[model samples]
Target: MQLGLLYSGGKDSTLAALVLERFYDITLVTAHFGVTDEYEHARQAADAAGFEFRALELDREVAEEAVERMREDGYPRNGIQHVHEAALEAVADLDFDAIADGTRRDDRVPTVSRAQAQSLEDRHGVDYLSPLVGFGRNAVDRIVDAELDVEVGPSEEIPRADYEAELRAVLAEEHGEGAIREVFPDHDQTYVHGLRE
Candidate 1:
């Protein structure tokens, strides 16, 4: 089956694509709201990883909603969860037979509850998969260390195409950098260059 895997040019999503490639024809798909040109980073990462790549354009309205939510909550959890669910739905709307993401077991935000996953599958007639849902951070890191060429840094500095980056851009443009900084604390992030040489 052809699979559309939501990619962020990060180690988790890149590894997810690698894990699923043997079983399905995988496309590394980056979803963006046209807030920024960061999606090109994911396309480059996909090319380096030897995977087919595509960009899934998301609605700007949703980006606005997420930004507002984050501003209200003073944290990015709910806003990110909202965007993740929407991105999943957008991916499912594609022609692929299956869709996947790189959300890990311990990830606090951007999680798809079982009911939500079921609903997506039922409504879209495509399987929804999270290849790393069963893996902990330590295990994922081990695999990345052994198998992938990834650059690790703070989220603000990392060259990635994740929703957080686009969302940050939107929030900064509309509100200010202070608004986003208040919502998103300092966290380490990764950018996948490719499989390790």
Candidate 2:
């Protein structure tokens, strides 16, 4: 079956693609929230791993809307869910039987909710597979050692948290601190400060 692997140029997503490709005709689908280097790295990783890769630029309409809600309501709207909605929109038109991501058993399943997973499958009328669901970090290391040529280096400077924080930081730095607060006033102050630091 044809599958779409959600790639992020991280060890987990890359390794997930490695495993899934053994059983399916896999094409890597990557999304970038305006991080060009991160997007390019994922593309190169897809080439090295021998899967066709497509990069999707993340749309911020939902994110911006969520922040606006938080600003008015004094509560953080569901940011991750908003992200998933944006991702779903980006891939809504792709031709594929399934969508895959790099989630593992060790990673909190709740991090990506059942609703989110179901939405990918149910809304898109495709399977949502996580090949690494039962594998952990060691399994990933062994797979990388055995099958892939790319050296698994120190996790790129892009921490998972950096995904959202970088957007907020750039807005704060470029526009002004007040602009960020106006957009995401309820965002954890410590996170914004620490990311900038």
Candidate 3:
């Protein structure tokens, strides 16, 4: 089966792609919200993993909507989820049997609810998979440690295709850095700097 894997060139997404490759023909799909460097990084990661790569450029309106919603809600919890759903919807037209993301068991935002997953499958005629959904942070870390070599850094420092990057940038610029802090809160954000052999 051909699977469109939503990739961000981060550890979780990259690892998910690797695992899914054993069962399906994996196509790494990275969604770019705005002018960012994530597409290139994701492409490189796909090359390193020996998987076909595709970059989907999301409409700017999607990012604008998320940002506007975040400004109104005073938090990004729901805004990011909106962006995620948009990303999944963006790939609905692709010729694939399934669409997957790296959302883990511990992920709060950008996670597809059971109802939402079912709705996608029902409406799109494609399966929705999250390989890491059953894995916690510790188990995922262990798997990454055992199976792949990777470099990690602060999420802001690492350039990967992420909705949050564009959202954070807009928030910081328009509302100041404090707005970013208020919306996202304190979290240990990390990204894969490089995927090693």
- Candidate lDDT values, in order: 0.93, 0.59, 0.82
Which tens-of-lDDT digit does each residue in 32-101 have in candidate 2?
5663345565666666556788877765555555455545654333544456556655665588888777
Across 89-134, the per-residue lDDT of candidate 3 in tens digits comes to 8786688999999999999878888999999998899999999999
Model 2 lDDT on a 0 to 1 scale: 0.59
lDDT of 1: 0.93
| Ordered list by TM-score, greatest first | 1, 3, 2
Q: Which of the two, 1 or 2, has more TM-score?
A: 1
Candidates 1 and 3, the one with greater lDDT: 1
Alpha carbon lDDT at 1, candidate 2:
88
Give Cα distance to truth, residue 174, candidate 3, Å: 4.7
Candidate maximizing lDDT = 1
| Per-residue C-alpha lDDT of model 1 across residues 107-150, encoded as one tens digit per residue | 99789889989999999999999999999989999999999998
> RMSD for each model, in Å, please?
0.8, 7.8, 2.0
For model 2, the stretches where C-alpha displacement exceeds 4 angstroms are: 34-37, 62-85, 149-197
What is the model-wide C-alpha lDDT for candidate 3?
A: 0.82
After TM-score superposition, what is the CA distance of residue 171 in candidate 3 from its true location, in Å?
3.2
- Please give the TM-score that candidate 3 achieves against the real structure: 0.89
